[model samples]
Target: MQTVKYFTQDELASLFKAIKKKKSKYWLRDYCIFRVAYRCALRASEVGLLTVAEYNAQRSELYCNRLKNSQNNTIRLDDETKKALEKYIRDYGIDDCLFPSQVSKPISRQTLDLLMRKYCKVAKISDKKKWHFHSLKHSVAVHLADSGLDVKELQHYLGHKNVNSTLVYFQFTTRQQDNMYKKLEQRNYLV
Candidate 1:
């Protein structure tokens, strides 16, 4: 399996901008898919498996079944994500399946991959990279680390049985030693 690297903040912002351009309906779906994937840190299957009802309307929380593990997860919704999901649900009426097919069935993994490829093409990102499903999990992990979340907190958020699983994400975002600098380098001013 290829390793997925973390994107710099600016790079991520640029990709978001790329997906937001006035392109086609496909781009809209692409944007929604990418944003949901990156923001929620869900596996591709989880994203495709989601249903409109997975969103708790009253609490504004989103739910998904953890992939590879039998755990269940519910997280507070992001505004942009909520908007995208709401739009998709309203437009498609896939109350039973958050991701849908024209035949009124759950979206297949292959279809999800195709959607991913289309977006990556427009954004000029690498499709060969292992940045598909769980890569989003890595992205979220980096984001949380950047936000100063502790490893313990992340362990719980990620639903990891062990804290070591969360460490991999930190490793992904860790800068080279040369890139590290002391904040205390400022001129001495004991004011």
Candidate 2:
């Protein structure tokens, strides 16, 4: 099986920090886009297809429209992500599209990919080719799996149509295995 490329939590923090340092006019928008993408495990196209109507500010819920025949789901937003979405919506005066381009349409997937590349470069992440926008999805998946989320739950969270697709993330890395072993030892499971 091919290895999945993803950012470590530290790398994600670095990426966000680098994005904030730019202080560009669209910095908030860019940051929110990446944050939402990672938090929701959304594909670039799914991010582009997001609509304001799909977000419920009062409930802090987001309706994710999955692609590639994946199951669509409505997920509750985390406090931080909820705040960011509220601020982005209020500040941008968004009426329809969640992340609109200058043309008032949803931003294109290519633009998202380009923005990811730009931020990855600013973050000084090596192997730029491996850290495309989709890496956000993989990063979140791995992070969630590492956090002890059940595989079935993760499958639903990722909107995977097949468990096999979700099972790929269950292949833990060496560091993850070490962490698990340490946890087991701490709990005296090895005794």
Candidate 3:
């Protein structure tokens, strides 16, 4: 099976920059969506259906009612994500949905996908073959794993029902694999 794809920090920054230049009315909302998804490792449906009531600023946790399964997850937000969400909430007013649609309801999964595609095009991001809305979630998992977060903890953080799902990110990247081999060679473990 092909490895899952993820966006690096540079690529995420590029996409954010492209989105900022649009001056669209929904820019703030979109920014919030992207930031929350990246930081929280949420699926598109979770991101789309996020509500203001689910965010507990004092706790810095956003509750995600998992769409794929009934088990819910409470995702911790980083300072950056908290700041962005605060700004968006202030500007948009916290009423029902965090990211309401034209009808003032939660955005649908299809609309979220379309918005992601539009931003990807605007950013001129190549390698569309591997990148998609779900890449943001993969990026979060990969980044956390690279930072030495225990695999079990990452599985819980990503709200994966099965540990096998989380194991994919633990499968080291090329650079990490090379480093591991070098260490083993230096330790004379390799014959």
Give the lowest summed-lDDT range of ten residues in model 2.
170-179
Off by over 4 Å in 1: 1-3, 174-191
Error of 2 at 88 (Å): 1.0
**What tens digits encode model 3's per-residue C-alpha lDDT throughout 20-90?**
88879989888888889888888888876788899999999999877665357898898988998998899
Alpha-carbon RMSD of each model:
4.6, 2.6, 2.1
> lDDT value for candidate 3?
0.83
Best by lDDT: 2
lDDT of each: 0.66, 0.89, 0.83
lDDT ranking, best first: 2, 3, 1
Each model's backbone clash number: 1, 0, 0
Say which candidate scores most in TM-score: 2
TM-score for all models, in order of appearance: 0.77, 0.90, 0.88
In candidate 1, the residue pairs with backbone N, CA or C atoms under 3 Å apart (3 or more residues apart, or in different chains) clash, namely: 50-98
